[model samples]
Target: MSRSSRVVFYSLSRKFVQEKQAPPKAQEVIYYSLAIGHHLGVIDCLQSRLECPLDGFNRWVAQLPSGGAARRKLEGLGRFGEICIDSTHTHLLATALSKAAPLLTDEQQSWSQRLIDLLQLIENEPAIYLMVRRRDG
Candidate 1:
């Protein structure tokens, strides 16, 4: 999270995006993970907003108090592993993923806006809230 780290992550993320031949799904997963912390943060956020308990509410809630740092660490390592998984694969992905790490803030902001919008809908719509709660509660 230092200035240098941001530079490195942004550089690598841009590199990955530049590769025309990398698989779209793989690239998306990497970028999404970088942006979303493997959806762990998203899940935690959603869990908190819901009136009803999700299936893993207990487990998820437990993890939330710990912060997303550990999840981000594991996710970061996983990203590196993805880049290195295939020896035959092009190195573009690896390089992009490394430099792209810093772009996470951008993704987080985008997702935050989206979550805000969605939460607003949830707040205004009794039907949706009931649906989420009746099904989930």
Candidate 2:
């Protein structure tokens, strides 16, 4: 699918905040595949950047209520960081986000609603390419 047609999610990393830089230009691109619903080529910004190591990501995942299920699903794929959630597993991701939202730092919580909104969108669509890219200015 064309880039313009995909649903994009942008995240600003700690590095971006520390550098005090502006968001990247719209033309800047980083890509990874995330299988959401029936879509096969969604881009995942988090995994592409390697901002958090696998161990850290695994630790965070372990804290979620549905972490075990999520971990198992992810491990089954033999991949880390990339969030390739299918329709059946949508609830798992949503539940994890809902539980983690309250524990997020104030800055992190600012985007919580947007993430929830995205999940809602996923629930409704038959296929969606969620492009999550870190805004590393």
Which one wins on TM-score? 2
Collision pairs in model 2: 45-132
Off by over 4 Å in 2: 1-63, 71-81, 131-137
What Cα-based lDDT does every candidate model obtain?
Answer: 0.30, 0.43
Error of 2 at 47 (Å): 15
Error of 2 at 60 (Å): 5.8
The numbered model that scores best in lDDT is 2
lDDT, residue 137, model 1: 11
All candidates: TM-score: 0.22, 0.41
- Model 1, residue 109: distance off in Å is 1.0
- How much is the lDDT of residue 53 in candidate 1? 23
Encode model 2's per-residue lDDT on 36-117: one tens digit a residue: 2114333323322123333333444455555367547544422422344445766776676677776665534444455556
Error of 2 at 23 (Å): 43
